[model samples]
Target chain A: MGARQTLGAVTDSDSSKAKRATARGRLLPANQEFAVFATVAVCFVAMALTMPSFLTLGNMFALTRGISVLGILALGMGIVVIARGIDLSQVAVLASTCGITVVLLNNGIPAPVALGAGLFIAIGIGCLNGLLIAFVEIPALFATLATGLLTLGATRALVLPQLIVYLGPENAWLQQFGGNLSIGLPIPVIVFAVVALVMHVFLVHTVLGRSIYAQGDNPETAWLTGMPVRPMIVTEYALSSAIGYIGGLVMVASTSLMHLQIADSSLIFDVILVVVLGGISLTGGRGGVSSVIAGTLLIGILLNGMTLLNLDTQTQNIIRGAVLLAAIVVDSLLHPHDEETSKQGL
Target chain B: MGINLSKRLPAIAAGAALSILAGSAMTLAANITRDTSRQAFDTAISGKKVAWVPLWMGVLESEWTGIMKDQFGQYGISLVTRDPNFNNDAQLQAVSQLIDEKPDVLIVQNNSTTLLAKELKRASDAGIYVVQMNMASNYVGDAYVGVDYTQAGHQVADELIKQCGGGKTSGEVALILGEATAAPSIEGLKAITDGLKKDPTVKIVSSQPGDWDANKANQIATTVLQQYPKLCAIHGFWGPMAAGAAQAVKNAGRQGDVKVFAISDGQMGDCDLVEQGLFTKALSNRADVQGITLVNAVLSLLQGKDKPGDKHLFYFTNNYWIESAKDRGYCYKVDKAK
Candidate 1:
């Protein structure tokens, strides 16, 4: 009887999949990755037309360098969002971990050890977020939000206590991560690109990756099929936090200071905006690596263009909001509501 | 889950209690040593508690705190700080909580001119001497110390007039403010613009709030540059954010063309940027001096024979323009090894 029910569901899914395939063919027929490719292309053209300096090597490099940290964080957020969860504490965890690392480094601890310990603490925070959301059954949003606050507060109390930790001249290796590598490419840009590629492979080609989709698609179904749903959730959050820590390291490297203030900025919201704009349905089970890249590129292009145009922050915010809203509208039209989609929180 | 919850609750409660106790102890100690003389303050405030509540302890605020922590520690004043982290409600609540704990002197860095005015008034009214730092409030409490922002702004404007307001360069200038509503930034920008009336050649091409964000400043600088290529100078209200404008200029291949100037709380980061020629000029309100001044103001209020309403003391620190490598006195580089 269980087998028959499973088979029936599979058949239903198969038919829906067929319909989706047909729809995708009609709408995005030429390129399988048309959504991401088209968005990047459009952003490039728009920026180049609006700002003459937008296409210059110097400006382009700066834009890429600026977005590297954002891209890294968004990559983590994308993974968590794809797994039918969200980690708002990523930035806060990053800040706390990075702040601690700086303090440790300042105290004469080796760079590698400090970096490792920081990453570990970040992962631990992610696990805490996971434990709360998965075991306690708290909503991912509230759990991560609460954790973010806790981590930031705790770090401020225990570490520098309202101080900015400036990495000295001795921490040259760490600085190099943010500084330039080759002729014009920043180390952070390279790191981001590499991380993106790794995440792409992990999300697309691995069994764990498939499980993430399964968990996102239908938690109940995934559990029924013998998948460890709670553990999967933990893994996803852990991965997000780990990536977020690296992003924090990149931020500190680029800026030469570990500022606890970064966590308080509207950065997490921007991460979520990038993820959603990339067509990662808040309903989950739909978006993947391509979505994050697409979203990051769109935001990067918009920001780069705005910078090149020398638009004020307020106007840039307006343009960004409008673009995000437009993206949401497009996403909604493309992916209509379904019962399975209801399981993932929008 | 139940066990974890029980464990976490106690840990959180303990942390809260410890912080409160530490906060109270610092205030009580500072109050206890109120009778100490000016010559004795360097020793009297030693080991005493001085709790600080800032709107948010950013790079600028932290530098002031760092100087205080070091100087006060050497003198025997224990500094306990509560960072509201830019939340107005949180700041108010922290102040109320800190006041209840009765710190010797509650030093507050107000977000707006008015957000903390009522609470600050209440603190002084409750016999807790309040030291308002850098930013002022309508309350005009026991002691007000820090930069004369209006004066600083006027100075910057006067300097700009010398540079661009004359017939020397295209007088097209831009103003990058920290926050639109922030009293200091707003007043400073106003003063500069008002001061510009002395010369008709200066045209304020773009004046926008960057929210004290470097990235935002970069974007603003870029746009303003594109709009007015002959822009002579961009005056930023904060140092780090001004660095963004400088970066934007560099990125635009107009580093030498457009000049970037800003006012900062003498942080090494700001000074370093200036020394690197990322900024044309930086008006640094020496944070270490301000920190010492804040300690002195609090000590005076605590020990002074004057009652609460008698005479509200105000100390204005001098601002120095860091124009070249030779003018880096405003900043103190913190060497952790020391």
Candidate 2:
């Protein structure tokens, strides 16, 4: 009996030790979490101090609404970047697809049908990008870049050639998407929030989501483990394009105009900046939804504060660039490279 | 599916046939006309394609293009257009490619005077008729069809001089420029400076470029208010942007103390802003008249009545000041119902 009790105690000790190790591995370090939290806190305090109206609810709502489209786009971009791939064509896909939808609706197509067709078109572009990158073995960057130009050119050629399709008065259903929910809160904010929640769940709860991380971490290992790596890559880009389409829709709604120029704007760079700044490693397989939110909030706060402070556009641009650089430096410092994960195409 | 297929088949067939017919008609039209302007327009353009590029096809450019397209399109005139969506390089490249296409007429809206000067000269020497629209270029083309910006600038400066120039009202004045290097902005600024020379007591306290952005104008006005407590008047180069500047003044609790002035393309937004007392005054350029004039010019050119360099044809549209809320007609507004 004595021997059995001693053995039981030893077994219990081993199990508890194993459980503690697993917990430690699964959760982020407290110090690291604290540092991130502190960065956000510091940004908020700085903005509040500089701009008298920065802390107001109206301004906060406006800032969130303004960043919603970019944030949504970055969520998908973050996913693609996490999978060891980049999509330069995301904005182009959004513009072309969204532009098509607006033109179709203007020509009397039903709203639902136009939206479905637009989203499909975006996915098709994404699939094309995937085929070139995965099957043809073109570099992701070049493939997306080429695809972006093609999409933009095709849009110009096929759609309303050089016209601003005004949908503000024609489409009430579409306009409602851009309208405020409760005075200050816009529908775009809600859309982004819902999307962020779903993406968080998807990344945490699903088998495919895990595979994305695995693929990003080590593509060969993922393939060796019987994962459908090529198809998965296609799906990843498809998701990005689909999300980009939604972002475009929100953009048209917010701006009250279907501008073909959005794709060519500095918007894509801003999206990527948000992703990278939020602690999502461009090397892939590291960051998730939380990182995106943090990055977006930081940027949104900075821009809102600048707006409130009445900073000139040039000065605002300079400050934004500087902040992005600082964020990158901080991220690099925090996540020192590990040889196994840092190499390209892993 | 069968019903949809049948419906689409006829539509597709009609589209194809219509396109083919249109193509043949254009070809036939191209073959029938001869260049009447080549000898006279030779100095302006003789050996090159004139690419008329605008920010985009809007009511303003459509009128301009209607004239050019009708006249130029019939005369075997090879006109190319690049819709830049207000982008700078796209405009530059369109001009460059037109140079490559070698047309004889290159009419353009200077996105800014300096951005396309080198290319404009290249087109000129390469032998292209370079007619600049409402804006001037650093490199003067053979002809410029636009307003005398300096005159407009002086007009506004004189008005401000009467109201606030002489330490009589507050001695503080603000200037809002469009894009920094825009030809109109530079010309307007120079004219205002020249006019200010006549009024020694007018102290211009703040001058900044709003980039022709309405939101930016508002923000700039906000900051200027913070900097100058006794700003008596504000002058802006564009209508919509000026309205935004006015809004900022109003928001800062200085609407009566600060007066806003601007120049506009008679867009309804400017008129509406004016009516709302967002602006103290706005100089209006009738974009509708401009458009109609452009169409008329194109028709005249196409009818084989005039050559390119025979004489410089200028259309100087009237500019009016909307000094009161009741003066809405002075500015142009696009009817949403239309």
Candidate 3:
């Protein structure tokens, strides 16, 4: 709900309006996605031409690998944003869940068991968040925020002896997710691709997925049409948390340690940035995996280039903020808010 | 039976006589008297209130708090701590409330150079002694207990020059800073910049902020390594975050090529990393020592000799280079407060 207003205001697409436009024989609504994709391409070529190290195989691998974790998280956030819900708790849940998993592994729990229990806890937190938002009628923004704090605090108090939990030497297999796979492609990139493919299939082909979109489009219409609106909302959040668990796993695997301090970093806002930058409309039910991919590429390239240029974090943050502002402006110019489509729920 | 009883009675009587003599002698040897100076010491410190407002309770802050708590308890002083959890607004509120509570001494770790300047002034005006730790504010307090980042940074840079400068290796060095605008980082960077002036051949090829995140450090370090495989040394501001940079170099098979040097909070983890060869050397300002310094400052203030905000005392702590296994004691093991 916090990021929703900020992101939702910049969201250009209204699925219902787009449907009406299509019904009226207009094929093209706007080219926000195209504009973003083109910008990414332009930046890519510019960086490659200017920076000698940009196009190397190693640099390319580094860029994609870095984006994998963020992309996975953005994908999860994209689903919730499509449902007109926000998840401020994703990073917190990810850190705590994966943190507890490593702690268990250190205490002799098998890899599979620890991983399962970790993801189970993550999904459970998501369900609690869903219950609060869907059935208890609390706003998603506040609900996730409170839950995030509760989970992080609880995990810190009960399990983590400190802010960081390092992976023990016994878990070499678990570390493979962060390493290179066959043909030298980083395992995180592979995992991201697999997740994107699976998520794409789920959203396009599943009945529950379609219902999530319908509910986001209009909760009143969705309920009136006898779609299990409450259950769908719960499932949407569960999916977001579950996917976030994968990102957490990759994070721990790659870094060999999970520092809970990351939950307090600006990583979540970056995830939201990728979601919106990819052309996923926070207005709900307007973007998918492709949009997330496009957004990730742009950001991944920008960050990688900035790193190559050795710009300080302050300068990089300035550029990042400017880019987000520019994207919002473009989105607003292309799709001005109309009174009929401006009914707010989140 | 009668003969045995008579013999045993004589022996028992002798033992009783010896016990009486020993008791009297012991009391005579252990004569008790209270010294006026000791009484004055107790009177100066006992029942005094010391309020601590740290930026947050990380490993470093926790160790510092642990030591302060133990020392204060021994001195019969009361200590209260408020953890702002790194939120600036919350810290400001905590300081405001602490001022109203009117503790005899207030110690704080400023999140920035200016956020708590006004409130600190208010506390000083209220006749409270203030001590700042690690990072200082625009408003200097009664005492400052922390490292001189410029000196520490110069030492680190000089160490780097010895390792990679004057055509020893490829003169390329990389810097992984904690935060761009943090006072410690700013001062440290300035010192490093000035120190590098002594060695013209050494080139700083890359500089970026890790924002105190290990993952960010890992990613950036990985990219930098990919770009400059011949990078001679990587200097980082903090230890835990620099562990990621070390790991990145290790993963690239450049661990032997790249020298990793950093300054740490001197927690056990930094020493463990050093022993494991993750860090070539670490210049640590032991948090435990800093905590003890803070206690000493508070105790001095509570002595009621120094005027509040008038006596600007500083306890610039000594730094330790934890390089080999022998430097283990330099890094404190924060298992239990001593």
Winner by lDDT = 3
Expressed as tens digits, the lDDT of each residue in B129-153 for candidate 2 is 6677787767766566667787788
- The positional error of residue B48 in candidate 2, measured at the CA in angstroms, is 9.0
Question: TM-score of A-chain in each prediction?
Answer: 0.89, 0.88, 0.90
lDDT of each: 0.75, 0.70, 0.83
lDDT of 1 by residue, A1-346 (tens): 1232234334455677646644543564222135656868987987778666677775667767767788899889988887788898998899899989988887899878998999889988889989988899999999999999999988977786655666655675676676665576667789989999999899889999888887776788888999988988888899999999998888776655666766777888999988888867787766777777777877877766665454666687799778877877676555544343445541
| CA deviation > 4 Å runs, candidate 2 | A1-37, A335-338, B1-63, B75-104, B122-129, B147-288, B291-315, B318-338
- The interface root-mean-square deviations, each candidate in sequence, come to 4.6, 6.6, 1.4
Give the DockQ-based CAPRI class for model 2: incorrect
Candidate number that wins on lDDT, 2 or 3 = 3
Chain B TM-score of candidate number 3: 0.89
Over B196-308, each residue of candidate 1 has an lDDT whose tens digit, in order, gives 98999987877777777665675567556655668899998887667667766755567768888898887777777776666888898877667657755665564455666
Models sorted by TM-score, best on top: 3, 1, 2
For A1-346, candidate 2 gives per-residue lDDT tens digits of 1232233334554666445434443453422324455777998988778767566665566677657888899999988998999999999999889888988887899889999999999999999988888889899999999999899888877784543444534574675676566454767889999999999898879999999988987798899999998998899999999999998888666533455655666778988998888877787777789888888888777766665554565787799888877877666544434344356763
Instruction: Please state the Cα-based DockQ of model 3 relative to the true two-chain complex.
Output: 0.45
lDDT tens per residue, model 3, A1-346 = 2233324433546766544433433333365677788999999999989999999988888899879999999999988998888999999999999999999998999878999999999999999989999999998999999999999999988887468876766675677778775565778899999999998888889987787777777778988989888888888888889999999999887777888999999999999989988777777766789989999998999889999999877789899989999888766554446542476553
What DockQ, on C-alphas, does every prediction get? 0.16, 0.08, 0.45
Candidate 3 off by > 4 Å: A1-31, A182-184, B1-34, B336-338
Candidate 3 CAPRI assessment class: acceptable
